[model samples]
Target: MAGREATNPGDSAILVAERLTRVLPGEVPVTLVQDASVRIGRGEFVIIRGPSGSGKSSLLYLLGLLDRPTSGRLLLEGEDTGTFDEDRLATTRLAKLGFVFQFHFLLAEFTALDNVQMPMRRLGRLDEAAQRDRAAQLLRDLGLAGHEHKRPSQLSGGQRQRVAIARALANDPVLILADEPTGALDTKSSANVHDILHDLTRERGCSVVAVTHDMAFAQGADRLIELVDGRIVS
Candidate 1:
C-alpha cells in the first residue's frame, strides 16, 4: 500500500464520491450512508472499517455503482454517475470496474476457465479465442493453472476464491470493489488474497477499495476509513 510513491488521494483520482448518501424511504426513513466523501487514486489500496451495521457495505455499494445514492454524486475516472440510467450504469460497471464478494458466486455448470471468461464475453472486447486465452492466463496467475477445466465443485475453498479473483480481473478492470473477499477463507488463504489485492496496486497499478472487519487487513491499506452510525468518524 505504501510503495507507489505517495500522491494526494484526490490527485489523479480514479473514483470520487462527494457528500454521497443513500437513504431507504418509508414512513420512517433510514439512512445508510451520510455525506460520505471518498477519493481513490490509481494504485491505491483502501480499506473500509467499521463494526457490523456501520454502513461499510452500503458505502461500498454506492461507490461501486451497484446502488444509487439518494443525494450528492459519484464520479468514476472523472465522469459523473449521478445522471446515468440503469443501462448506462450497468454498462459502465461492466467496462470499468470489477467486483469480489464473500461468496465466489461461480456458476455450478461452468469450468474455472469458462467462469472467468464470462465477463469478457459480456463486454465483447475480446474474441472467443482471446477470451479463453486471457481467462486461462488469469487463472494461471492466481495459481489455478491445472484447475481451469474443473468446475467450482471440484476445487477447494481457497482455489475457488482464487478463481473468483481471476474472474474479477478478467477484463483488466481499473478498479476492484471487494466486499468481505476473505471472510470465508482460512487464515492462510486470507493472507494470500490480501497479498493479491495489495499486489494489484503495487504491481498492476490498479486501485482497490475493500470492505472488511479485519484490522490486520486495514494495516496494509494506504487509507483506512472508518464509519459509525452511517457517518465517517475521527
Candidate 2:
C-alpha cells in the first residue's frame, strides 16, 4: 500500500521476517513500520487489520517485497532478501509473489484470459500453449469459465475481482498479498471474494496475507495480525 515490504523455508513457512522496519526519510523522519516480525506459512490465511495510517499497508508492502525495509532481515524461502539488489528483488517478486488490490489493475482492453496469462508471459516459465491452458483453467477455477474472453469492462465487479484473483494465482506463487481485495464490491460480492481468498489456502496450498477492515474476513483467518501506530499489538 501507500505505506511501503519475509518468509523462510522448512516447516511450510514461505516467509520469515525478523523485526522489519521501514522509515520514510524527511526533515523529521517518518517511520511507516517498526519492529514488525511475522511468519507466513503454506496454506495459511493471515489477516492484517489496523486503522488508517496505522501502518497496516506499510507492513503488508514490506512483507510482499514491494518496499525495502530500513532495517531488519527478511528471508523468503530461507534466502535472505535483505541482500537482494533492486533487479533481484523485482525478479523475485515476479517469480515468487502475487498481488491483488482494490483496483484489480487489469489491462483495460485485454480479455480475462490475457490478463491472467500476463504474469506467466512475463516469467516465461511456460510456452504459449501451456500458458493459455493454465490461464484458462485458473479462470475457470475462479468461476470465470465462460467469461474468459470478456474484458474487464464487460465483467461485473465481482467477475473482475475473480479475474484478478485468477491473475494473482497465475504464477502459482507461494504467497498472495492482497490489499482491500473486496473494498469496492457489493456485500455479496465482498463475501464471495473473501470466500474465494480463504479457499485458496485450503485448495491450492497457497499462503494469503491480506490487509482488510472486514471483521468477518478477519475472524476467519488462521491468524489476525493487528497493528497500531506502526507496531504489532495484541
Candidate 3:
C-alpha cells in the first residue's frame, strides 16, 4: 500500500480513505481490499462499480466504519479515526453515518414508522414524540406517507426499500453509505431508489457512496470509482 497523499488544503472532503486495505486470515490470507484511497465531498454522489468479488462492498464497510481496516487510516470530516476506541467508533457511526443495504433488514415485526425510529431512539437526541414525528416525516418524504404503520411484510418491495431508506435517514447523518441498495428491486423500483438518493444529494446536501452493479445508477453519480480485483482501476 502507498502512503497517504496530500489533499488540497481547501478541499471540503467529508470522508477520506488512505491506502485502505482489508485482509482476512486463513491457511492462506485473502485480501478483500487493497490500497484503496478515495475522498467524498459534501453533497457528492459517488458510485463504486465493479465485477462481483471486486471488493466493492468490502470497501464500503471500511468507509462506513462497520469494519476496521487491517492497515490504513480512515478519516471522517478530516478527523483521523485511528485513535477511536470501539465505543467511540460506534458513537461516531450513529451520529455521523447512515447505511442502506440490498436487503431492507427492517424488523419483520416492526412497523415502518417504528423501524425508522430505531436509530433516533438509539441516539437519544429526541423525545419519544419527537422521534415518532421525525420518523413519520422521513417516511412521508420517501413517498411512504400512508404506509408508516405497515410492517415490512405488508409493503411492496419498493415501498419496503423506501422504508429502509427512511430508516437510514433517521439520524440525519452527514453521509449515506449504501451497499447495492437497488439490487433486489425491479427496474422501476431501482429507478425510484436512484432518484431518491440523487435528490438527497441535491436537496439535503448529504454525501452518498453507493456500491452498485447497475450502470444506470452509476451513471447518475457525480463520480464513478471503478474497481478490479480488489484495486481501483479507474
Highest TM-score scorer: 3
lDDT of 1: 0.88
Give TM-scores for every candidate, taking all chains together and pairing residue i with residue i: 0.95, 0.94, 0.96
Rate residue 17 of model 1 by lDDT: 84
Query: Which portions of model 1 miss their true places by more than 4 Å?
Result: 1-7
What is candidate 1's lDDT per residue for 1-234, written digit by digit as tens? 111221344548998888888899999999998888888898889888888998999999999999999988798988999989999999988888899999999998999999999999999999999999999999998889899999999998889988988898888989999999999999899988998899888988989999998777677788888888777773
Model 3 residue 52 CA deviation (Å) reads: 0.5
Looking at model 2, the pairs that clash are: 5-61, 5-62, 5-63, 6-15, 6-16, 7-14, 7-15, 7-16, 8-15, 8-16
Q: Which candidate achieves the best lDDT against the true structure? A: 3
Candidate 3 global TM-score: 0.96
The ten-residue window of minimal lDDT in model 3 covers: 1-10
Residue 12, model 1, lDDT: 81
Predictions in order: lDDT: 0.88, 0.88, 0.90
Clash number for each model: 0, 10, 0
What candidate 2 gets wrong by more than 4 Å, as runs, is 1-11
